[model samples]
Each structure stands twice: as structure tokens, then as C-alpha cells.
Target: MAVIEYQHSAEDITPAQLNGFFVGWPNPPTPDVHLRLLRNSDAVMLAVDTETRQVVGFITAITDGVLAAYIPFLEVLPAYQHQGIGQTLVRRMLERLQDLYMIDLLCDTDIQSFYEPLGMYRAVGMCARNFARQSGQ
Candidate 1:
């Protein structure tokens, strides 16, 4: 299939096409929670299948719109991997957040190359997780 179109928010998005994401996660968020997180974020970029109108991938960031911002998530469904959809979503999302002074994200070393080409820099970071909160209440 040809690359899908991009949308800014959940305006026409449905949960049906949101499947196959969070691949390999031990505690992945549900589609409904995913929608909540995206909507709650300061910015979001979504890639939708043109013919099917399904969300194939998405990226989200929360920021103060000035000094700093943090990217909480970037995901492309399993079937859509290796097709540059992930990169496209990140490019669009970064564009939307270009005004922010410091844009940061925490990711595994294996995925560092993905962001390097998009103007992101590598940095040390710390994080904490309570698996019980993986699924929002």
C-alpha cells in the first residue's frame, strides 16, 4: 500500500485501525488509553492509511511551548515497520515542536540511529516505571 496521509489529532481516528502497535512491550497501553495520551499531549502527529483511514503510526510530545518538551511515545504498527512511517511521524512531530528550546526523548540505544538523522542528539537520562500504571485508570 502507498504511504498514508498525515493528520494532527484524533479528529477522524478510530480504534479499529490502531491495532498491531506496542509490539514487544511487556505492558502496552490500550488503544483507548493511547488516544487519551495523544489527545492530552501538547502535540501529536498521526499517519493514516488513505484508503482505510486507519492510524498506522503516531508520535506524541508534551511541552511548555517554550523552554522544554519531552516525547513520550513514537510508534508504528508492526506491519508498517521498516517502511519509514516511524521516521515520517517523528519528522512531522518534531516540526510541530520546532519552537521549543529543548526537545528530549528516552529511547533504547538500538533506536538511537532513528532520531539522529532527524536532528536529535544523544544524551544520558533517567527514568522510573510502575508497571501497574501502564494501563491508565
Candidate 2:
């Protein structure tokens, strides 16, 4: 696979490049909505497949720009998982938010180790989910 081209901006990103994301999500957001979310976020990191020019992975965070930040999404296309792309995306986004006092994210228990190596520690957090909102419709 060709090396991914990483860009910090949401410009020039089309719906066609955003296919095949939301893996394992029963009610994942559509590409158009996904673009809206990214555009609305405080910061974003995109991993574009160099060969196909598709968006294979991405991470987004909303922040107060002073005290705290919350990562709302991180996704890597199934075909591109285990290739260190996810880790790199997270690391880069964290660096972007390093000036803040708190950076938080919610993820499956199994993925804890993935973030631990990137200087993130285990923490207890509470969350509420409205399953209906998963589609962002």
C-alpha cells in the first residue's frame, strides 16, 4: 500500500473519498454527515490513501481551546486497520491538543492498550448514549 497523505484541513474533501468508514457501526453516519461533523469539529486529522486518494481513516475532536477537549470520533477503514494508521492519527491529534489541560475520548475496552502506548492513561469516565443519534440524522 502507498503511504497515506495526511492533511489537517477539511478543504477539498469530497463524499466519494469518504466511503467504507463506520466499520462495525450498526447506525453509522453517512459520508455527507461525516463531512459536516469534521467541518464542525475544533480540530481534525485525515489519513488519505495515497494510491486511491480515498479517506481511509480520520479522527476528530471538539475543544474549548483552553481547558478541555473531547474526541468524538476515530475511524480506520477495515481494510486498513492494524497498519499503525490509527495510532498515528491519534498521536497527531493529541499533539494538536496538547496545550489543553484535559483530553478525553471514549472507546471500547479492548482498545485501551492502543492508546496507552501513546501516553494516554486509563481513566474512568461516564457517558450516555442515545442509540438513535448514532446516525447523526
Candidate 3:
């Protein structure tokens, strides 16, 4: 197993290092857009492979700093999935937002079990997406 490093900032990150995410999205963001997304997010946690200097996984949060936080993305590269990176990312992000009154994320039913062990509970929520802008162009 490669040495994995977790970081909370994207300061020196580049587009090339962000390849291979958003696995099944029809219009995944390009690397540059991904970089922008990371920078724009209120908080981000990244799992990087120290040996290859590649970002293998990431979770992004949008927070109001006091009351609520919404996790919009949590993804691991296909090759890196099932390696505990995703769980670690979520845990770290949650810790960072622990002071908030609410921390929320929406995921499919199939993945809800993956989060239950991490202290997240199932909740009803609604979302609206504009697929045309999914790439964050």
C-alpha cells in the first residue's frame, strides 16, 4: 500500500494531480474546474498518495461557520476505493465542522450504510441539480 497523506488545503495543488475522479458522472468537472472547486469550497480534505503525488480522494464542504454545513462531494479514485481513504476523508471533514449545529450530506440509499458507522444518520432532504453545469464550467 502506498503511503497516504491527508491535507486540508489545496494551496499548491495543480490540475494534473486531480485526475480520475467523478467516476460515473456524465459531465464530470475537468481537472482545472476541480481545482477551482477545491479552492472555492469552505473546507476540503484530500487523501494523497505521497509516493506518486496524486490526489486519490477528496471531500468538500460548504459551511456557514456557525450553524450548518453541507458536504457536497466525497469521492475516491476508482483504484483507491475500498482502502479506507473515503472513510477517513469523511471523518476528517466532519471533525472540522463539528462546531456547527448541523452537518449534512446527501447520498444514495446504497451508500448510507457506509456512513452510519461514522456517526452520520439518515435524514430526509431535497436537492436540485442543473446537469448542464455539472462540469462547473
Candidate 4:
């Protein structure tokens, strides 16, 4: 594991530094689109590899700023998946949102266990996806 720096803001970040993410998606966002979303997000936490100077993991949240917050994305590069980067990003994001009354995210059942130990609980929710626009056009 190389030196990892966690950042809350997208300052100094560029599309070149964002690659190898959105793994396994058929129509994943390009690095440029990724950077745009990061910049637009209400809150963002990034895990960067100091040596490579690349973003290896990131989490984003959308919030009403008073009480409700929703985590829309959390991803780590495939090579960095098991290195605790994802966990650290989530923990930091949660801390940043501690003042909110609700912090929610929707993840697959298999991945629920991962978030559970980090203080998340099971919940019923509904979501809709438009794969045609998944690449963030």
C-alpha cells in the first residue's frame, strides 16, 4: 500500500488524476465526467495515492443541508479494493455529515455487511436507474 491521502475538497484535482474507477460498469463515466461529478457533488471525499498522484477511491453525497443526506457513490479502484481505502472514505464522509439527521445509501445486499460494521443498518428503499444515461451525459 502506497501513501494514501484523504481529501474533502476537489481542489487541484484534474481529469488526468481520475482513472481506473467505475470498474465493471458497461458505460462507466470517463475521467472528465468523473471529475465534473466530483466537482458538482455537495460533498466529496477522495482517497489518493500519494506516490502515483491518482485518485484511487471516492465517495459522494447529496444533501438538503439541514437534515437529509444521501450517499450516491462510493468506489475504489479494482486494484485498491481491499486496502481499507473505501472504508476510510466512508468513515470520513459520515463524520462530515454527522450533523445531519439522516444519512442514507443504497447498496447491494452482498455489500451491506461491509457497511454494517461501519455503523450502517439494514433499511428498505427503492431506486430507479437509467442505464442509457449512466455515463453521465
Candidate 5:
């Protein structure tokens, strides 16, 4: 297994390194927009391939800095899946948000098992999505 370096800041990252994510979305955000979101996020964790300097996985959270936080995204490139990258990103992000009173995320049932081991539990929640705005324009 190749060594994957994790980073808490996107200071040195470029949109070019953020390829191969948001795999199945009907309208995924472009790498430029993706980088923008990462910059705008309250917290972000990235898993990078030391050799390629490519972002293989990432997780992001938005917090009010006091009572709550919402993790809006967590994804690992298909090629890097099952190598524990996602787990590491989540674990690190959780630790980063440990002071929050409530940390929450919405995931499909299929991936719920993945988050379970990291101390997250299933919950009934509601959400609204504007497909046209899915690309984060």
C-alpha cells in the first residue's frame, strides 16, 4: 500500500489535484468549485497520495463553532476505496470537531455501516436538495 498523507489545510492544494471525486452525481461540482467549497468550509480533511500529490479522499464539515456541526460531504476516489482512507478522514474530522455539542451527517443507508465504526449512529433526519444547484454554482 502506498503511503497516504493527510492534510488539515488546503493552502497548498490546487483544483488540478482534486480530480476523480463526486463520482456518481448527476451534476457534480467542478474541481474549481470543489476547491472553493473546501476553502469556505469550517473544517476539511484531505487524504493525499504522497507520490502524486493528488487528493484521494476528503471530508468537510460546517460548524457554528459552538453547539453544532454538519458534515456535508465525505468521499474517496473509487480507486482508493476500501484502503481505509475514508475511515481515516472521518476519524480525523471527528477529532477536529470534538468540541461541538452535536456533529451530524446524512449518508445513504448503504454507507451507514462505514461510519458506524467511527462512533456515528443512524438517525432520522430531513433534508432538501435543489438538483439544479447540486453543482454548487
Candidate 6:
């Protein structure tokens, strides 16, 4: 197993280091836009492979800074999955939002178990996605 380092900031990250994420999205954001989103998010957690210096996983959240925060993204590179990186990313991001009144995210039913273990619960929610803007242009 390779050494994995978790970082709370995206300060020195580059597009090249962010390759291979957003695995199955038909219109995934380009690395440039990915970095831009990371920069714009209220908080982010990254799981980096120490040997390759690549960002293998990340979680991003947006917050009102007073009452609520929504986690919009959590992804792990295909090659790096099942190694606990995703769990670490989510846990760290949740901890960062622990003080907030509400911390929420929407995930598929299959993945709900993943968050349940981390203290998150299932809830009804609605979302609108503009496929054209899915790439976060």
C-alpha cells in the first residue's frame, strides 16, 4: 500500500495533479475547472498519494457560514478506491463542518451506507442539475 497524505487546503495543487477524477461523469469538469471549484469551495479535503504526488480523492463543501453547509462532491480515483481514502476525506470534511447546524449531502442509495457509518443520516432532499453546467464552466 502506498502512503496517503490528507490535506485540508488546495493551495499548491495544480491541474496536472488533479487528473483521473470525476470517474464516470459524462461531462466532468476539466482539471482547470476542478481546481477553480476547489478554490471557490468553503472547505475541501484532499487525499494525495505520497509517492505520485497526485490527488487521488477529494471532498468539497459550500456553506452559509452560519447555519448550513452542503457537501457537493466526494470522489476517489478509480485506481485508488477501496483504500479508505474516500472515507477519510468525508470524515475530515464533516469534522470541519461540525460546528454548523446542518451538514447535508445527496448520495445514491447504494452509497448511503458509506456515510451512515460516518454519522450521517438519510433524508429527503431535492436538487436541480443543469447538464450544460455540470462541467462547472
lDDT score of model 1?
0.84
Q: Candidate 1: minimum summed lDDT over ten consecutive residues — where?
A: 11-20
Across 12-44, the per-residue lDDT of candidate 4 in tens digits comes to 899999988887899999998999999999999
Query: Which is the winner by TM-score between candidate 2 and candidate 6?
Result: 6
TM-score of each: 0.92, 0.96, 0.98, 0.97, 0.97, 0.97
What tens-digit string does per-residue lDDT give for candidate 2 at 53-137?
Answer: 8998999999988899999899888888899999999999999998999999887789899999999988888999999899899
Candidate 6 runs further than 4 Å off: none
| Candidate 4, residue 36: how far the Cα is off, in Å | 0.7
On TM-score, the leading prediction is 3
* TM-score, candidate number 6: 0.97
The residue-level lDDT of candidate 3 at 25 comes to 91
Across 1-137, the per-residue lDDT of candidate 1 in tens digits comes to 66688888775566676777778877887888777787888888988888877788889888987789999889887777888899988988888887778989999999898899998988999999888887675
lDDT of 2 at 80: 89
Specify the poorest-scoring 10-residue window by lDDT in model 5: 106-115
Per-residue lDDT tens digits for candidate 3, residues 48-137, read 999999999999999989899999999999888898999999999989998899999999999999999999999988999999898888
Q: Model 5: how far is 102 from its true place, Å?
A: 0.4
* Model 4 local distance difference test score: 0.93
The Cα error of candidate 6 at residue 133, in Å, is 1.4
Per-residue lDDT of candidate 6, residues 1-137 (tens digit): 87999998999999999998887889999999999999899999999999999999999999999999999999998888898988889989988999999998998899999899999999988999899988887
Give candidate 3's whole-model lDDT: 0.94
- Clashing residue pairs in all predictions, respectively, total 0, 0, 0, 0, 0, 0
Global CA lDDT computed for model 2: 0.91
| Tens digit of per-residue lDDT, candidate 5, span 9-120 | 8888999999988998989999999999999999999999999999999999999999999999999999998899999999999999999899999888998899899999
